[model samples]
Target: MREINNNEYHQWIKETKEIIDKFPERKKSFKTSSKIPVERLYLPSEITNSYLEKLNFPGEYPFTRGIQPTMYRGRLWSMRQYAGFSSAEESNKRYKYLLEQGQTGLSIAFDLPTQIGYDSDDPRAKGEVGKVGVAIDSLKDMEILFDAIPLDKVSTSMTINAPAAILLAMYIVVAEKQGVSADKLSGTIQNDILKEYIARGTYIFPPKPSMRLITDIFKYCSKNMPKWNTISISGYHIREAGSTAVQEIAFTIGNAIAYVESALETGLEIDEFAPRLAFFFNSHNNFFEEIAKFRAARRIWAKVMKERFNAKKKKSLQLRFHTQTAGSTLTAQQPDNNIVRVTLQALAAILGGTQSLHTNSRDEALALPTEESARIALRTQQIIAYESGVTDTVDPLGGSYYIEELTDRIEKEVEKYLQKIDELGGAVKAIEEGYIQREIHKAAYDYQQDIERKQQWIIGLNAFAIENEKMPEIHRVDPIVAQEQEQKLLELKATRDNYAVTSTLKALKEAAKTDKNLMPYIIDAVKVYATLGEITNVLRDVFGEYQPS
Candidate 1:
């Protein structure tokens, strides 16, 4: 970092002020979601480096530019559309559809039951099976979910936490049955339980036990599944839950710090598992700020890994991430307007250098996207990659004065947050004390106040008025899907060797009682078609459950 000469900057500002003072300004101030003020005009003088501190090249140390030298030039960002709903069979059709439409990877969304480790047959599961996303009660459902899609050929991302290991076990067994080796598997699991406790509220065990499960995955995957991304520490949900952009990066990086420290405590070398770590982020409506946030995220994480963790490998420091357009910004009133919102957000993700992206369907704020809407969302990504010329260069907005300044602001703000979290004893303690939650809640409240005061405009939500906007037909899941799922679980239990199922679950419980990694036991249990609830129940009896205040 270099300091700008104030003497030179003052002279430039004085000379420029005379001509600029004659022009009228629109607003008193312009700022980003993180509340950093943007200058009316950015010059090389505003850059602390005096615009001469050697900016590192792309793929170099600190990775301020990008992780890849040939970002989107040799290969475009992977198009992994998030799609899953109804039963595994139904979701499988959707996955094949997306793949045929030139989607490069698969992103699976589990129904609430599976997310919380419930079998479809559990009384607690009731009407929720297959409603929000795909329901996979056992290996049987996972097999149906993948169907003819070869796991070896396609990378998959499963958004499952708390019971992430169980779901991951199911995925591994499915691939094995497809004759794919575990080493051949490539994908990411949202095994990040910290964010769930902070925002999503889908946790199963206490943070201590939950963290143990996460590190166990880290150990197992490091040895067996080398190509796999062990965890996607997420800021996407945090932003959706209404944190400012700075808070999103701050809290997410803080959580990553906790995970790294936990892994080191487990006696695993940093390089042994750091490269497998990844991130998930939101691409919100603020185009330039969103791009700057991504760039800042990479730079911050690189410094943290190198300076704090003492990681040697460049891969260990690189903050590879997937981006999804913000669902929170979508408006049900002007449902059609969401397409434009998604396009801008998706474009920001690309310009900011995401490894992959998921574009939200315009109708998602209303219901599960219909197939037509999903296709339109995919088309948005395709058009951006092919027709939009922005992908021609790496970090096209990298050198812009506004972008660099904004990126530096976000990076500094995030550092202040990290220092605060450090004083409170890391991410878990900050979350347990509700510090992170309170911060996000306060920001969200302030944002709502701005909207109400007409300081912040939300197009159809605030500025535009529509008295009787006709609503489009939204997709509705068949109520019969739950009953069908329940029957399948019952039939599988009755037909399979019950003794084998019981034995594997008992082994899982025994392993849970000890210091052994639990993934193998989970794999064995799911292989015999043991219900998800049964496997989770064994752990629940051992590790107990987590209930936040």
Candidate 2:
């Protein structure tokens, strides 16, 4: 790679200074734990022209090194622990507890009923309300879930897909009640429905309408909530469902390509909606492989946005993402072993230059994390941020020979997968044809076979011999949580203006039939305190439900 000239170096320093001004670096020594001095970044003694072209400086195009000029130096990645369970009131308390424990952001996990757009009182929602996550039925429930939490103060990521629009509308209405404008909201909604069909099974509508909802979110957020991430095209579920690192990158980018194309087809400018796009990835067991996957993902996304879509803005080309440590890697046999695994995976994510991260709790493999376990998980991030000198530099592992070689290999493999996906007529067609599902199923089955054959070693599982391990206390949702949530919904329905609810539902159903954006209608329905099921039923009537063949 060509050597960076003195003038170029000075220009970069100027930009770095501006970032540091906004987010001052931590006021402490930038040294190793043993007090060994460390540089802000490490570079090779000699440079070649090709190296510079491939791994340009941080914050530059094809952002292989990092996105920001002074990655963690200017500011550390957001520590967002995913939390939610039981009723909205209970989840609200947990959110407060996590914030007090030093979490920088909130990642909400909604229950199955909320995810699929059913009211807590719906017959289909019986016995499942607040089981896996917090159950939200209407604006009343959303208001309770975020009770005292100011939306403008903390970024919140909601893991909702098919019903993302309705939940988002409810959130917006709640913020308005708190005097927080839509423009001030900063967070992401996992609004990518394609992944639900591919790996997860939380999908509601068919692919055509699902794509429409995603692009509508892109369009609405671009015009109103500029700071909000419209859709977090996710590979976390794919990896959890048993995909290789290369498959993770390929499938994610393929889905992203499909989203961008759909938005463009709707007459939306690529740069307008692309800048708000975000990604979600999983950091798995292999230390170096996880880091390489993140770097390779960024480089591939940058090139695709700029070269394929002709994106003009720098933000549009930059691939910002949030990383969560692999839930699949956790072991139920020896739960404490998961802490070590999570630490390794978390470090890899930081080293790979993630903008935000959530480290899984040690007890998550067995159940929802207890308060004590959640604190330990948050402390894991705190220890790494404050003590571990990893945050002192940008892309600490960027120049490692193994990392570089692995990154290149992952990128090439992803390109091959993307080419195949394109040939299969993009992500939507690939899913419709069961091509993507088959690939992930095969990989998952092969992985299981390897573990059974002792070809792969998972500590405390196939390799380690442990007997009668004592179980730690796990968080359990109250059995009466469903009854309480159902009662709350019943009370809401009894008091709310039935006439207004009926009117809004009618308007929403009509809007869903036309090509017009449905965000405004959704917002209107939510404002009238229409339940999630009520709003979704309107859409389900217009757009038939999706059933996997």
Candidate 3:
């Protein structure tokens, strides 16, 4: 193989430009799934030399292709199907079923009440307990969550933001009870409050205190839970909320940077907590673009960690992440069509070299996934790994002229957003000023307009007319689930030592009042069976609620 000289490169660029310019008008109309038109064709000439340097070989400085040299060839991406609903017993059965069906990891989804620091019995939690996910009010619920699964063996991912610290503390306490040392625990917590403000809207305390809680997790995990990922800075919800690919990459990295800043402000070294930081992104229907986005994300993050944050460890600079197929992309009209959509999206994530993945169920557009639908989703990943032969080569699409060009183009576009964010005094300031939210809103509106005008056709929704089709009966949360959960919470309160609970909660309140890390205090309270509401209420009184400006 011979390397092309500058003159040869320029000649290829000139020829490519000519070909692009000669294309017909219809061909020139580049449209995304969101129906946003691309102004011009992206070419190798559009990429800069600096970008090429930044995106080196896989496993090298600035891991553009991937963090691992062999990627899936070494080990297939972990298939982690997110599941949790009703009670802990029900969720545990689901977990065992998933494990038996060949899921490689476990990802726990908590209910809205648990997410916002409320116990199942809280008056505010009425009608919501175990509705969206499992209700874990204390260590008892945590114990039931992992009943037969050995804590030291299975890696778990918990989706909880505002009360992340409390949940993480309970998890640790439970692991200890199971004879698993703190250092042996392996998992991740979605301790990303910034995205909660931007997209998810599950925040409890104000941003300042929230940041402190996040930093406390980082500090605690860095020392105690060595294998634990401190934060899953997520763009999954951002994309689900309808942000463009550029916005997803830009905003997610911006959030990660903000977390780093918060941890550093606590006087922690950059490499200390940075290595444990992981990302979560959405894999939408745009196959090549989604793949390019993940590649660009790794490259951009590696550069940021090394150059901006002065991170010394290779793991600190690497951008390892989990991908979830975009839930927003699923169509409810012909639910079966979603299976095809999910398969394609899952393939894109595998091609993008996600460290782990969760393929959304076809029924997700209507309600929580049924057992059969969840099995199909998990089987999608298994089929891709074993049957498709896509993993036979590392970065099979790596040297494709079109793919490389797209990857470089995406990196440049994300860089532009980063510069704009830097000018606005970082992500916190941008979020405070509502810049991120406004951008996402505009993108969402534009996509909606496309659907309205038929410019972008969702097969079942716009193009293919499926009239009078019998819709599947969607799963609705049982109204009695809340009452059952409430009774259990009340019984626990009656059985536990009320004075011990009060004392532990009082200590937690005192800890919250001071600058001390709340993790230790939280662990203490959880050990005494202090309810989630009591712990969160004390912190609420101290930190107060966040009213977006």
**Candidate 3 regions with alpha-carbon error over 4 angstroms:** 1-23, 27-30, 34-54
lDDT of each: 0.91, 0.90, 0.89
The TM-score, computed over Cα atoms with residue i paired to residue i, of candidate 2 is 0.91
Q: What is the lDDT of residue 115 in candidate 3?
A: 94
1-549 in candidate 1: lDDT tens per residue? 777588976887778877777888776464344477876788776778633332377888677788999899978888988889999989999999899988999999999999998988788998898888999888898999999999999999999999999999989998999999999999999999999999999999999989999999999999999999999999999999989999999999999999999999999999999999999999988888999999999989999999999999989999999999999999998899999999999999999999989999989999899989999999999999999898898888878989999888898899999999999999999999999999999988998888897778888988895988899999999999999998997799889999999899889899999989889889999889988899888999998999888
TM-score: which candidate is best? 1
* Model 3 score (lDDT): 0.89
> Which 10 residues in a row give candidate 2 its minimum summed lDDT?
29-38
Point to the candidate with the largest lDDT: 1
In candidate 2, what are the lDDT values of residues 421-540, reduced to their tens digit? 999989999999999999999989988887887767788998785988788888888889988988887898899999999999998888888998999999998998898999999999
- The true-versus-predicted C-alpha distance at residue 296 of model 1, in Å, is 0.5
For candidate 3, lDDT tens digit of each residue in 1-549?
999999998999998888878876765364566332344666656556565575567788778878888888898898999999999988999999999999989999999999998888778888888889999988889999999899898999999999998899889989889899999999899999999889989999888999999998888888898999999999999998889998999999998888898899899999888889999999998888888889889988988998998899999999999999999989888999999999999999988889999999999999999999999999999999999999988778876556777777777788998988899999989998989999999999988898898877799898886889889977777778788887888899889998998998999889888999899999999998887888889899999999877
Q: Clash totals for all models, in order?
A: 0, 5, 0
Q: Ten consecutive residues with minimal summed lDDT in candidate 1?
A: 46-55
Please report how far candidate 1 places residue 197 from its true position, in Å. 0.6
Backbone clash pairs in model 1 (N, Cα, C under 3 Å; residues 3+ apart or in different chains), count: 0
